[model samples]
Target: MRCFMLHIACLCIASSLCAIGDDIDEAMRKSVPPQLKFLRVYGGDDESMPPIALTSRPTNLRRPNIPFNFSHVTIELDIQSPTPPQMFVVFSHCNADWSEHDNSFLNDPALLRTSSIDWRIAPPASVWYSYTGTLKIPNEHVKFNFGGNWKAKFYLYDDPQIPIAIAHFFVVDPRVETRLEVSGDFYSPRNTVYSSGAYTIDANVRSVDGMNDGQLNTAVFYRLNRYEEPFIVSDISSYEDVNQRTHAYPLQTMLAGFGMTGRRFRIERIPAENEYRVLNLADYSLFPRSNAPLRMLTPDLWRNGSFFEKSDGGFMNTRFIATGDRDYIQLEFLLNTQLIQAEREVFVSGSFNNWKPDPSWLMKWDEETKLYRLRQWVPRGRHSYLYMTGEVDADNRKAIRLTSEEFEGNTARAGHTFIGLIYYREFGMGGFDSIVGVAGGSVYGSW
Candidate 1:
């Protein structure tokens, strides 16, 4: 009945999500993760951490803010034992229906693979063993049926009667900043919109492993393209002494594509020779459209605006703009839903403010503009912002859903990813915003 119980739980989550509205946003905000969400896990039978356990045995690593459909993931776990032990990990999503095209594969039932991890034999209960493994998750999506929801499970089968351990896994919602589409509006501490300004763009170049964050040898490579070719910004945003996460680069030097949303800049460990070797990613923006709902995919930079010390010192500018068209800038989303607003000081910071989310730098209300704003003129340059919502998912039970694949006749399959390139180009003004009009939304649950 474990499988049935889990299935029931997912269904309840799906139903709760569909019923949510502005009238209930307050009640739902506390229990659910913002945006769409999902959940799953694996480990020993400890059950302390539903999705994980504290054991030397192989376990799956947990990640947040992955796009719904196109977010491809391959989780690997290493195991060493005198005898091999049974294992399983749950990969689930939520929706009214969880069937694939042929109805043979369970859409969000569980993640299954023949070759996931190999285990070394261990002594029965007497010997303790462990294995090291990794999960390779790509920004890819899969769905069997034309339109439906299904979670999956990946595990080691010990026997038909019982199993070793299962890691609980689930899909989750992405935050506003984590949204792959639509750049938010830039705001200052005074709650003002700085549509025009010499902005600062901080270039943070590093591997996911953080191994080569070494003193970035004197030069920093920057490529900026407003949805087109990458322009190499060499010998810019350098520091007298190299720092860890980011290196500040000024935008005044940028020839074009400033203040545009699709503008993408990659900070590479390698400095360019002539200019960037730009590759076409269909639309060629920093973030890929393959993952819907969460558009505007500028990696590494925080959604809230960043802050720095001003040369003048009178006003501390916590917000900035892209310095070109005014489309790409720091935007803030205040959760003043009369629910979670009073308890928190929603602020911004991250790769934006060197990882500092300062309350002092938080935006204030602009009585004149009738909007919250954070504006100051420290130094005009292109810099990243860390948009802070200061709010958690309404409930951990809700999941963030993304359009993973295109089905036959718009009928989706089990693990098919749609080429969103064509669909994205046709988006009208406030391109990503138009997504709200979509009638069909994927239901999901969060951890």
Candidate 2:
């Protein structure tokens, strides 16, 4: 009787496997390849929210590029809508009175052209019912610890089952589930009313990954130094821009710049609940000249604010003399391994080169330095940049799509050789979110 029961159990297991295999086979057989394929790209593996970039450094920036005060986003769908009866899901962020991020995702200037941008999918239909989509984020832009506001919607045309169910998902950045550290120092003080000084200020930002990536956007605040008050004055300091982590990074190329002589100083974190949240201290007399290399926050405080020992956390108190003469600008950036000959081609293009792609700035293989590099006396503090690698071969004349290629997801070696990122199965979604990614690292930046 025991042997008979065992045989029955084996048969059940075999049947389930056979069913799964049959479903895949049938789905492909009936489904006709649609003209276009909907693709979602992000740095990390979070399907719901933003993607966290696991790739060590910033990879090659794709065609549509990264611009200051703005980001380029794109998503292609393979649904059966003829005109694709457009519908949109949005997160209307009040980032700068809603200017930089305008209501214009529908007008993607660089839409994938015919044939070149393959829209092939299995089985085309007249209408899409239960559709699914993916969201991509930059490497820097991460979610808040307790979750933040990220608006999303679903726009399906002519579908009676679900016409326009604008789904709103407000959840924390993926890091909340683990032990994540988000800390930084302020170049200037946050609430003091004071004039500018001959001091240099900068901050370092980072995230938790197999490789180190310290880059983020920080909201810096300035006020009069005399009376510790949040200065509402319209001085240059008051109208200064924010700071980023990747100093002189290709994303911007240079760090952030803040050159002003305000009476006092202070910096504020932006976006999250801590935006403009004043740094906590018993008195405003915390700014003093110390010869020691200042440790911003105590280990425990930075690690996880301790038992009120110094728990009122905000910006780490980092300041320089208020002498209003020196280059007060600060350049912050993230450093990933430099590009190699095997990975990408180098080209120098910009207004400096008559808006032409110059060969001089073309990266040279630094055998000695062991890195591909281009050095320029960038603006003192911070700036943005782009790394363009023109088309390579005939088939890959445009962007390389690993998803198009059928590889078993083995792009690298753990113990042996250092293989590049999986180029085949990994869908290379074009947009700022495709390469380094905007989420989970730094969302915004200014200079």
Candidate 3:
């Protein structure tokens, strides 16, 4: 009898500990303030352009390029604190894969950080966010000496060690002429049936005066608006392979040919996902200022194999919003699966989150309502998003590989902007990866 009572007492203690753990998790989630929401980097003149900088004037005027000036890679964010938050920006020169460069010549640690940020209070009617912050790099405090992938980390002035937010951008000192071509005659190796309408991208790099053909053996591609995710194709097979534990396909390289002048890299079996679903919050009548959470008027339905609407190529537009109307709204998203349950985790990804499938954006399955629901705070703008289904990468908790076809569908007619970057393994300053060439083109257009 005493043993039985002890067992019951032990179970009660375990239950209490589990309850405490649950409460702690909930508290941590609640502690994530909206101050770090919607951190974005774009061109100074045009927010639609990618966050890429060109250090030199283009010699070939006809080729498509990342047109933004080196000083115009602007970082914009919103802070919801009562008073302005003391924020600082630190710039890190990164390798082709975004790892920080250790060389002092490439990454000058002393001159790459700043505590200056332009802050403005929100309009009187703005309730969700209190302040807006903007910072343009290559400014007075910081400058870029090397051309490569870059990351701008935002940190609180008090807590300088840990970054609260990070934004990816590019600085290019173009040395080669790159041409990009997109073809639709490709299929995924792992999932051929679902990816029957995949696209193939070929990046042809022509060596210029300063380029070394042997070192230029790698190319990375991005679906313009989804800059955070890169499709890397390298001469080294191991560099192209994905993490074995992740739900991602091995590097989809069709060819990587070396030539006397330059190199040609081809990445095939790229899923041509359907056009993005747009969420317009600029219309005051449709999305009026509300003290309570605003729910999507209509629940999102799954588009298994159908797409009709034209999209903005995943660009977020805030030009139509009034000055006073620019504020964050508590938006509720409801995805009605029509009683069909998802086999993997479902997440809503968009330009708002840099197209990343963050666990915070995960949808909860409602058995009673037979719907997937998520409530999030979003800014007032015209945004594009998609419903994604995939598992969180076990190796990298911050990364996830999602398939749009499982919920959004795939189509050959869907237009996408592709950016191809040529990487050269520069041997100067103990070796660093440099982007020597850049090309941009649309799936339905010429390079």
Candidate 4:
């Protein structure tokens, strides 16, 4: 009956999603390919901090925005375990477009063999027990001779078909210099009726290497912050220069919606530290599921667009312990949705679920309590989460269209970051896309 109850619950939410509107069908079809599921995944230059529990890397290390060879970034993975199985990480090459490329570069022996990976057993830690694996590109076992797009797939060593986790990274040769200019604007230029905020991107590329033909055979890819999908442009007319070394592509329409800000609540904050305010998710016993709509954590003081600033002000804290053991907390999330009349579905999302709107995280409406609620075995740690609403498209997947702004309001202050990259492909000679330029930055916004 438990399985049947869950199925009914999913159907109810899925039905609500499909009923939202006609436009959502196209939006859902455009959903980017999902990443492989894993307990934890991290990537960055060799010198960056390793992935740990109870925390998320503030900036994505996988899509490095720095001007360096794509081979410079390394990926690390920690697979969740009951009894861990042997696993190996494999790399797949992609074209300037994110589609998989059927080129010989991926068939190289160095990448085909298991010797390229440096596997290690995770140190006994307070949060959870699992095996960790590392793969550094351009290592002795495998080297990325040419660059385009690369995805590292983790699979069982003995059974390659059984996959584990997946990560995306980049490599660049920097043959061209690219400049990006971003401006904030209303969603529509003519009217401000439903205005939140939008970004207009203008890009310019110039040949940095005298031998290169520059923007003539290049594609520019731009993404807002860490989003997986990229806005791409590749037209000779977009180039401002005829010698073809320089090109400019301006946004015809502003990218709509105020980018959702980071989570304001700190579930992982240490209690003894007077400066930090946090909800203690350690004791499920204290908060049991009851008829009176068990008031879960204290009524959250909605702080729109607020972010944490630790003493060190570093990207993440290395010394903080997020959880005590492998045991999970049966935490219930409660949100008052009485004022919300739209036929949209709501979800709780954060770094734990790769910032994606997951079905498991979907919240159900309670007619009696006039609230949306979900119960899950969440591990104790500092969790960053946002209350977002959207439809579960025909794909049965959730894509956000409305955030907590209904209650939280639009006047939240938060930081927004953007990353830009330029890719090039020569006419002949294996025709692989190579990175030529990179740039990234953050902007602060209120309302």
Best candidate, TM-score-wise?
A: 3
Q: TM per model?
A: 0.23, 0.20, 0.86, 0.62
Question: Candidate 3 lDDT, tens digit per residue, 290-314?
Answer: 7579999999998854776776778
Q: Tell me how far the alpha carbon of residue 354 in candidate 1 is from the true structure, in angstroms, after superposition.
A: 18
lDDT of 2 at 414: 9
* lDDT value, candidate 4, whole model: 0.45
How accurate locally is residue 60 in candidate 3, as Cα lDDT from 0 to 100? 41
lDDT tens string, model 1, 1-447? 999999999999988887766548756544432110111222222111112111111112332222232223333332443233345444333222111133323323343333344333222321112333334221122322211122344444544333233232222221111211111111122223211111222222222222122212221121111101121332223321222212222122221122222222222221111111111122324422221222223212211112222121111121332212112122332212212122233443322232233354455544543434453211122332323333222453211110001000011111111100100111222111100000001111111
**Candidate 2 residue-wise lDDT, 1-447, digit = tens:** 999999999999999999999998878744543222222322123222221223222232221111111222223233433332344333322121111233233223123011112222222221231123333332133221111222233443333234243222222222101111122322221212211111111222222232122212222221111011111111232122222210111111122323221111222322111111122222225422222222213211110111122211211222332212111111111111333242345442221221123344454556764544554311111111223343223541322111100001111110110000000111222211111111111112221
Mark the regions of model 3 whose C-alpha exceeds 4 Å error after superposition. Answer: 1-34, 56-71, 125-127, 186-195, 236-238, 242-247, 394-399
Overall local distance difference test of candidate 2: 0.24
lDDT of 4 by residue, 120-187 (tens): 55445413334445666555555554555666677765557745666666655545455555554423
Off by over 4 Å in 4: 1-71, 106-129, 188-195, 211-225, 236-296, 299-319, 322-330, 377-383, 393-413, 444-447
Q: Of the candidates numbered 3 and 4, which has the greater TM-score value?
A: 3
What lDDT is reached at residue 160 by model 3?
78
For this target, which candidate reaches the highest lDDT against the unseen true structure? Answer: 3
